[model samples]
Every structure is written in structure tokens, then in C-alpha cells.
Target: MLDQAFLLYGANGYTGELIARYAAAYGLQPILAGRNKQALEQLGAELKLPVRVFALDDKIAMQQALQEVPVVVNAAGPYDFTAKQLVEACIAEGRHYLDLNGDAIIYDMIHTYDKAAKDSGVMLLPGAGYDVVPTDCLALWLKQQMPDARSLKIAFAVLNSSLSRGTAINTVLKLGLPGLSRIDGKLVEEPVGKRGMYVQFPGMKKKLFTMSLPWGDLSTAYVSTGIPNIETYINMNKAAWFFLKGQGAYNWLLKTKLVRGIANAIVKRQSPGPDKATRDKTNTLIWAQVSNENGNTLTANMVVPEAYTLTALAALLITRKVLNKEFTPGYQTPATAYGTELIMEIPGVQRGLVQ
Candidate 1:
């Protein structure tokens, strides 16, 4: 048995493939798994790692796969559909569950399994990837800086990156959904792009325009820091911001099955994601602020590698920690489980307060 190995489901997907390819660099091996037998075999052969063919629906096979490894890193998307099932299996098998999910609803869903996971000695950590790693770490760091923080805001932008087919499809599915925020300790719905601002991120000469977004931190950050008010944002250009601000006018059309089908088809016909050249040159900018009751605020900025690159590295980092017997059982965000400095573990990450 390989001592440092985990089962990587969805290994056929773009992000999953990346994680499998990079596993050796982290001094680990991944047992490639997924429903696509042919694809899994191809990936297994290339990586020279074991392959387990099983779908999430196959209870026996999945359990066997779980038995082969101490951890499971789910790189699948539309996590709302995938997370709960994998989490249940992990709990039953006493295996740690980790995923690259950034959906608030999935976080809320997985949180309900805290006690079961704790009892089973399984760590239920979602957003082990770029979804909440950088932002969650920033939230905790800011909380430490302002212990009495009343509100928190986080914003991020992929300087030059493209989404994988799975991510693009998920985005299409959420076209008509409302934005979300935590207000006074309650999750509330708000219009997408309801608010816009300009932020001068560190290392950038000009301020980037950002608009309100319903990021996963709306759920994870509150649990991580206990801040009563929280909101998230994404960087956008002026034209895109204006277009999103007016999303109400055509949201109905966007939600229609026909439109979603067309959009998904287009995404499928496109490249899997940014090419290697693009990913190598890309970066992500993250900005965050925490404020006290008196309106005093402290702001911080961070820059990391492109989204997909960071996701693979971050996921493996957490997996390695679990392999090393370092983890808190039960539901956890990255920073809350690891600490605010966890984000710094990834290569090419720079973070500091904005003076």
C-alpha cells in the first residue's frame, strides 16, 4: 500500500487531471477514480498510479475505493449535486472528505453533517481549492487583526484566466439566482451586482472595478470568524459591471432551459480551460476588509497563482496535512481548520495589509 495516497474522484475532469499530474510534486500518489472507465485508465497509465472505476451511485464500489485510501479529494463540480453523496460515503467509511466546491448552498448543506463527521473521525472540509482558501484565510487574518469586527467583505479577480467546462456550466445554471450575503448573522438574498466599487489592490497600478457577488464565504466566513455581516465581490470591467447591474431585465431568459443549453454547448465546444501557457502567466487578486462597530476598518490584499493552479496546490496541501495526521474532524473551512497562514503555503502567494 502506498503510504501517502488518496482517492481522487473526477480525475477525468480538467482540475482533477491537474491535481493527479501534480500529486508527485507533493510527495504523494492519487488513486484516480471516476465513472469514465476509459478516461480513468488513460490518466492512471500516464500518472502510473492505481485507478479505481466507480460512480458515486455505486455504494459497494465507492466503499471499496474509500477503503483503498484514507482521504478523498472530489474535483467534481456542481457540488450541490455531488458533495452530499460523497460526504455521506466518507462519513460512513471514516474517510476525510475534501472538495474544490465554492458554492454557498453546498457549504450550508455539508455543515449539517458536522456531528456525524466528528463522530466518525472524518473531516468534512469543502472549498479546499481556490474557492475559499485564499478568502477564508484572509477572513481569519482580518479577524485576528480586529477581534471586534462587525462586518467583513471579500473580493477576488482572476487577472487572466478562463473557466473549465464544468465551471462554465455551473455558472450557466446560476444565471438567474440571486446574490447572497450574511447580514446581522442571517443569510439574505440580494440582487446580483447590486453594489459596485473601485479597489486599489496591492501590486496593481490602477483600481479594479468590483461588483457584489454571492461567493461561498457568505456561508464559510461567518462560521470561520463569527462576523455578523459579510458580503463578497468579484472584479469586473465597466461594461461587464453595467451589464450585470441590468441582469434583472433578462434574467428570465437566462434561466430558460433553451438559453442554458445553448450556453453549455458553447462552453463544451471551447477549450477545456486556459491553456498551459495562459495558466502559467495568470494570477489572481484577492482583497478583503473587516470593520468594527465604530467604522474602523483594516484592509488586506493577496495575490496567488491562477485559479486552477492554486486549486490543485491548495487541495493537495490540505490532503497532505490529513495524510500527516493534521486535521480537525467535522465541517471546516480551510483557514478555520488550518489557520490564517495556510494560504501562504501555496507557491507564489503574497499577502499583506494595505497601508
Candidate 2:
């Protein structure tokens, strides 16, 4: 045995459960953990794995749990609430920490702990999933083609996929947030959808409209490639784009606690995530372009499995590598630690230069 055991907090969440169910296939053992005792017990029995039930606030219990594994995969979202606690504990305990978060702010916060993580010989990797892995890799790949690139743009689109309840609630919670981008090597905030474009992703028949937002790449890609200006966009239909532009009018309402509470209540009543059948049919598309002052540019495109599916695979893949002692001892994005080929390791991923 390779002693491939690790701790998986929030193991009852949609993405976490998916990772737990597939841990065996990856030749790893995950000790399921979370606050929901009932859910954790059922899942642990089904998966035949050890179980640890403790809320993130239960510091003593959490620290005791950390002693069972050398790595922790956090599948909990709205990472703004969960990341700080778990990351701090991981650094203190010298355990590698990984999360499937794509929030730019969260990435920046984690980066601030780089020195502590390095000093502790702990690897802190955020966005170890769909949020940034493919795009981060693509960004680095495009940068490789244009080593002197001054600007970078990356976009992603999901086809035939639906959001998990956790993802939906997180979206509602951030409804009125401003967009973010990196300019002149600094993070800048601006109106959401401040920039829009049409992208013809690989294998797609037609172009899709995309709007720039504060994606995790706005933070992580800059670390991976010192591109001075980086922008990230997500595909949206014209109607959605129009509504997003008009959101400023109701931004205040969306930010109110009452509206957010109602939104979350509704989200909780829905399905947790796409069923296995839907995940099997969905595809994720990503595009990256890099340009220099002289107008030289290179574009790359990639197609991968559904977002949630890819999240599960990528999170576990990175976990497996960490257990095998194949990781750096500091803060890292997927591409920064494992290189551009990290995305290619997923079974259904394909990448190529744009023609």
C-alpha cells in the first residue's frame, strides 16, 4: 500500500461526495469529514471509509482530526467562510491543504499565507478543481507560446451542465459583487460585464458571448505567469448579459440580507447537483489568449468533462500526487505546482492551438 490516506472535510457536499465515491479508483483512502453526522455516517458506510464529524469551529476536534492524515481536501464552498479556518489549521499542523474554490479574493488570502506554509513545509493549493485548473493550465500554455506576453485573457463555457445547490447559493451570496481583473500586475475592481466578447471555443459550432468577471484566474494566473494584465470571462447569453449590465440598478437590493436569505432558502429546496447522467453528458470549454506589446498573440483552446466531474477528478488527482510526495512546499495554483500538463491528466481533457 502507498499509505494514500487523506482527510476530506465537507465530504458530504456534492463535489466532496463525488470525490469520496471515486477515491478507490484513484488508489487512495479518504477519511470522510463534515458537520452533518447523519450524512457523513451514511456516506462513510457506503464508501467503507473512516468518518470524522466536526464543525470547522470545533478547533479541538478539527486539530485532532488533522492528526489522522497528512493532507486535507476542502470541498466546502463560499470559501470566504471556510478557507481561513482550514488553511490556518493546515499550516499550523503542517498538513497540505487543498480546496476546490475559485474565488479571486480567497486565492489572494491564501497567497498571503505563503511564507507560513513554506515555513511549515505545508503545501497550500486553492482552486484545485474546475474553477481554475483547466484555465490556469491553458493560460500558462498560451504564455509559453508568447513568453513576452503583456496581456492575457481566458474564458470558459459549460454546456449541458447545471449548478450544484452549494454553487447556486454561493452565486446568490455574491450577487451584487463588482468584477475584478489584473491590470499592470495589480488587482482592480470594476463593474461586472465591463467587457464582453464572442468566443468560438474548440469543437463548438458557433461563437458564444462572454463577459469578464473576477474569476480565480485573475489571481492565480498572475502567479503562474507574470502577465501584467489578465482578464477572465464566462460564457453568457445575450439576455443574461443585458440583465447583468442592468444589475447595478438593483445591486443594493441583492446585497440586502432579506433578499439573500430568500435566495438561499430557495436554493436549499433544489437538487444538490446534476445527476450522474447529466454529468456524463456535459462538456466544459476553455480558451486562452496571450498578447505582447508588438501585437504578437497566441490562442489555445481546451475541452474537458463537466465542471463538477472535472472538479472531483482534479481535486483527487492533486491529492494523490500530494500523498505521493510530489508537491511544492508553499502556496500554489494547479498549474504553478504541477505545470500545464496537469489538466491533460484528466481522462476527457483535450487541448490545442487555435487555428
CA displacement after TM-score superposition, residue 155 of candidate 2 (Å): 0.9
How do the residues 1-355 of candidate 2 rate in per-residue lDDT, one tens digit apiece? 2279999999999999999998889999999999999999999998889999999999999999998889999998889899999999999999999999989989999999999999999999999999899988888888888899999999989878789999998999898878888999999989899899999998889999999988899999999999989999889887888888888899899899999999999999999999999999889989989999999889888999999999999999999999999999999999989998999999989999987
lDDT top scorer: 2
Q: Report the alpha-carbon TM-score of model 2 versus the true structure.
A: 0.98
| lDDT, model 1, position 236 | 82
RMSD of each: 1.1, 1.2
Stretches of candidate 1 exceeding 4 Å from the true structure: none
Candidate 1, 215-326: lDDT as tens digits:
8999999999999999898888879888887888888998999998998889899888888899999899999999999989999999999999999999999999999999
lDDT (0-100) at residue 50 of candidate 2?
A: 90
Cα-based lDDT for every prediction: 0.91, 0.92
